[model samples]
Target: MFRRRASVVLLALLLAGPVIASPPAIDPAARNPPPTIALSHFDRFELQPVTLAPGLETHKGNVVARQYLDVDVGERVPRLIEPRNATPVQGEPRTLLIQPEVADIRFITGGKRVLFGGFAGSSWALVKLRLVDKATGEVVAEPQFLQHANSIAAGYSLGAADKLMLARLADMVASYLKTNFDAPVGSAVAAAAPPMD
Candidate 1:
């Protein structure tokens, strides 16, 4: 009888061991976090044409005007990415280019200037940008939308406002990539985890 009871107790302990000793359920968000692409992994940066805006025709006769906007925005990307260990190469590895599409844009020309019709009031520009892997043509991350506006009260000329708008667009792209794609390891995982009860 003593032997039988001991055997029964041993069997019960064995069955309960796994149940009691099991680890706490891990947060699923922590287990499967968003993907991050290191900037160092990419070889270079490319800025594509501004697609989806109505006034690109304004650049029809002026090569300089088009180039000015493109160069200004293009140059800003490398300066922003390099500090984070990414180099902007003209060729090599795989170029990660930003494809910008204009979502919305408005130019509030108030009145003609005293001499010529200078832009009077304000201008608005909204752009959406996404990262594409030049090699695979795959969009590696979510699209980012950003907007900027300049008012006459702020004393910004139309040209200056346009430049400012381009700057803001570059800023948005750089800021988003830095925060999402270049986040420190484990930081994203920790961020996804739920609070402890």
Candidate 2:
């Protein structure tokens, strides 16, 4: 009986050896987090010409609205991004491209706006934008923005509210870029520090 018990214990120990020697399973992502991108990673930003959706070109006033958005956003984004040139330099690694497209648009003319006001209907514009890395051809981010012009008071003065909506859309895009463009603390410090030489 004593010999049989000793053999059973030895067999159990041998069976458990592999389990004890092997490392526990751990997620690789937990050990090393994925990389995150910040606006500081880019040295230049390019805003592409704003475009209208395929079917929207036939709609009345949409072409003009597209032009307005193109100018408005084009002006505002550069002020916030600090780079106006769309041309990529040779061997440039840190350039970002911003593409804005008008997905949908509803335009209420001034005459209709004055006569019907909010009863006629509200004017609205939907814009879809993407931020892409010029070097790697990777899309960094894609976001959509919507702006509306609704005026309950019907009058000549408020007829141009639709135009104001375009301006508001531009503001929204600028604000979004500004909020996300924060440089990492380390990078900011390094940039501020003078040359060691």
Candidate 3:
């Protein structure tokens, strides 16, 4: 009776060994490619329809304006995709969020022009931006405060001009990522494979 029981137990252990001894499963995030940036709008600032013109030459100095710039992913995504060599698998890439804060915009218009309306000068815009991982809530890129300046024309809307300059900045960022960010966005160190006994 004892010998029969031992044999049965031995058979059961042999059958269960394969199931019990498998290594732990890998995290789902590891298999995927880098996170793609999600479509995002400006949070702290608002884009108004009103256009900005060369107002009266202020006594203080350059005219200062405050507004948020909007990023249209539908329009800009193709531009971002252009520089990247790898075609990431669809539906597998994680999502990242782009946030921008407009600190201040300074317009430098001095003297007076004849044909173009006035002797308009360059406009310098200060902006703060960040990129964050949606799933992990990690800040992928360091907080950046950028000052982008462009020559102001006669009929250019403030919002439209701001959008164009910001879009160029975004393109530069995408190019940087294409060249520098080669590895997975935020992959953890892989665990060693379970040793075969």
Local error of candidate 2 at residue 50 (angstroms): 1.1
- lDDT string for model 3 (45-117, tens) is 1112212233322322222232222333224334544333244445545555545444344433222212222
lDDT of 2 at 99: 87
Model 3's lDDT to the true fold? 0.36
Q: Which pairs of residues have clashing backbones in candidate 2?
A: none
Q: Which stretches of candidate 3 lie over 4 Å from their true place?
A: 1-74, 81-93, 107-121, 143-167, 183-197
Q: What range of 10 consecutive residues in model 1 has the weakest lDDT sum? A: 188-197
Task: Name the top TM-score candidate.
Answer: 2
| TM-scores, one per candidate | 0.49, 0.64, 0.37
Candidate 1, residue 145: how far the Cα is off, in Å: 3.3
Give candidate 2's whole-model lDDT: 0.62
Displacement of the residue 160 alpha carbon in candidate 3, Å? 10
Model 2 clash count equals 0
Model 2 spans with C-alpha error above 4 angstroms: 1-36, 83-91, 114-119, 151-156, 183-197
What local distance difference test score does each model get?
Answer: 0.47, 0.62, 0.36
Q: Which stretches of candidate 1 lie above 4 Å from their native place?
A: 1-40, 52-68, 80-94, 108-121, 154-162, 184-197
lDDT of 2 by residue, 34-94 (tens): 1146666787888899999898787656787898888988778877666534445567558
